[model samples]
Target: MKIIRSRDFTGSHAWEALDIASMNGITTRLHWTDQPYRWHVNDGEEVFVVLDGEIQMRYRENGQEQVAVLKVGDIFYASVGTEHVAHPLGVARVLVVESKGSV
Candidate 1:
């Protein structure tokens, strides 16, 4: 068993993640970032939870770009084929759960 204090986590680069656990083919990770992630589609579904700070989540739907403001405690769900990116308002910690090896 392990205990993690998400607010206390930091990384040297954007989107650097700390592996938490893996079950079946899925993995859970804690990420720290102050920059935006490149747009990409996950190989499977994804669950993004904001642990601290705020994020501007951008996505494309029906060929139109959209954005969502995700604050601490907000959750974002991305289904397969959903092209999306995350832009942190500042330093942020996020918990992400998705298939192993997914980008």
Candidate 2:
């Protein structure tokens, strides 16, 4: 068993992550970022949880672009084939769960 303080985590680069756990082909990770992630579709489903700070989540739907402001405790679910990206307002910590090796 392990305990993590999300607010105490930081990375040397954007989107750097701490591997938390892996179960049944899925992986849970804690990420620290001050930059945006590239827009891409996951191979499977993805669950994004804001642990600290805020994020501007941009996604595509029906060929249109949309955005959602996600703050602490907010969660974003991305199903297969869903294209999305995350832009942090500043330094942010996020918990992400998705299939192993998913992009």
Candidate 3:
């Protein structure tokens, strides 16, 4: 097991690293300080779990829409192949889990 502080690094509004996983999934923990960034899609689906503070999930919908406001213990999932931008209502930390499998 490993523990990481979101701001343990420098020049970053957020911090994240892969902890442990094998063949099944990958788990990552990230911390943000009321600063949300745009999410770039690559591969696999991702689930964001809010660890602290509040985060507002945003997505493009012709105009713009507020997906939802997530707080501590709140869980949200985003599908692959989409662009998203998250805005922090307050200092926020989140654990992001991504995996590739079908079952």
Candidate 4:
């Protein structure tokens, strides 16, 4: 087992992730970002948890785009075929749980 301090983490680039665990084709990772991510659809389900700072989560539903502001401790769930992207307000740390190679 390993202990991680999410607030103390940083990445070389936006959306760079540190792998935390993988079990039964599911992967858990920590991501650091200060920029926005491109919109994309996941092949499977995804669980996004904010660890530090804030994020503006944009998603497309029924051909419409919507946004949600997520703060620390907030969780966002994305099911298969859900097109979404994340825009961090500044520097943010996030924990993401999803199927292996789902991106």
Candidate 5:
């Protein structure tokens, strides 16, 4: 077992670990005050869990924009190649697990 300290990372309120060889990883986000906003497309499917605070999923439709807010204890998912974005609604924290190849 391993313990990752939240203070390990400076300026960023998040930590990540995954199957380096398999390109799978898990990431934890602190709060929006720490720029909890994230825009990433995983190499594979991924899941997001709102542990604390709030988060919002952003996406574009017909050149317009849309959002889905998620509160604590909420969960969501994204598929590979599906362009999407995420950001904390306020001082929100989240955990995301996904496959990331070769570190």
Candidate 6:
């Protein structure tokens, strides 16, 4: 058993992550970043939760770009075929759950 503090997390580089678990082929991770992630669609689904700081989640919908500002405690669900990316406003800690080995 481990007690984790989201606000106290850090990474060696942008989007660096600490693996939390892998169950049923789904991987859970804690990520720390101050940079934007590349746009990509998950093979299955993705759950993005902000633990600290904020982020602008940008995605393509109906051929148009959309943005959602996510604060701490906010959760964003990306269904399959959703082309999206995350831009951290600052040092942000995020919890991400997705299929194992997914980019």
Candidate 2 clash figure, as a count: 0
Query: In order, what lDDT does every prediction score?
Result: 0.98, 0.98, 0.63, 0.96, 0.56, 0.95
Across residues 62-90, which tens digit of lDDT does each residue of candidate 2 receive? 99999999999999999999999999999
* Model 3 worst lDDT window (10 residues): 9-18
lDDT digits (tens) for residues 1-103 of candidate 3: 6655653532344533334344545545354555667656637777888877788887655556548888888987777755566677866667667764311
Off by over 4 Å in 5: 1-33, 36-38, 61-64, 101-103
Better of 3 and 5 by lDDT: 3
Q: Alpha carbon lDDT of residue 33, candidate 4?
A: 98
Tell me the TM-score of each prediction against the true structure: 0.98, 0.99, 0.65, 0.97, 0.60, 0.97
List CA RMSD, all candidates.
0.5, 0.4, 4.9, 0.6, 5.1, 0.6
Q: State residue 51's C-alpha deviation in candidate 2, in Å.
A: 0.4
User: Where does model 2 exceed 4 Å of error?
Assistant: none
The residue pairs that clash in candidate 2, if any, are none
Q: Write the per-residue lDDT of candidate 1 for residues 35-67, one digit (tens) a residue.
A: 999999999999999999999999999999999
List the pairs of residues colliding in candidate 1: none
Model 3 residue 36 CA deviation in Å: 1.6
- In model 5, which residue pairs have backbone atoms overlapping below 3 Å? 18-25, 23-99, 23-100, 23-101, 24-99, 24-100
Higher-TM-score candidate among 3 and 4?
4
lDDT of 1 at 24: 100
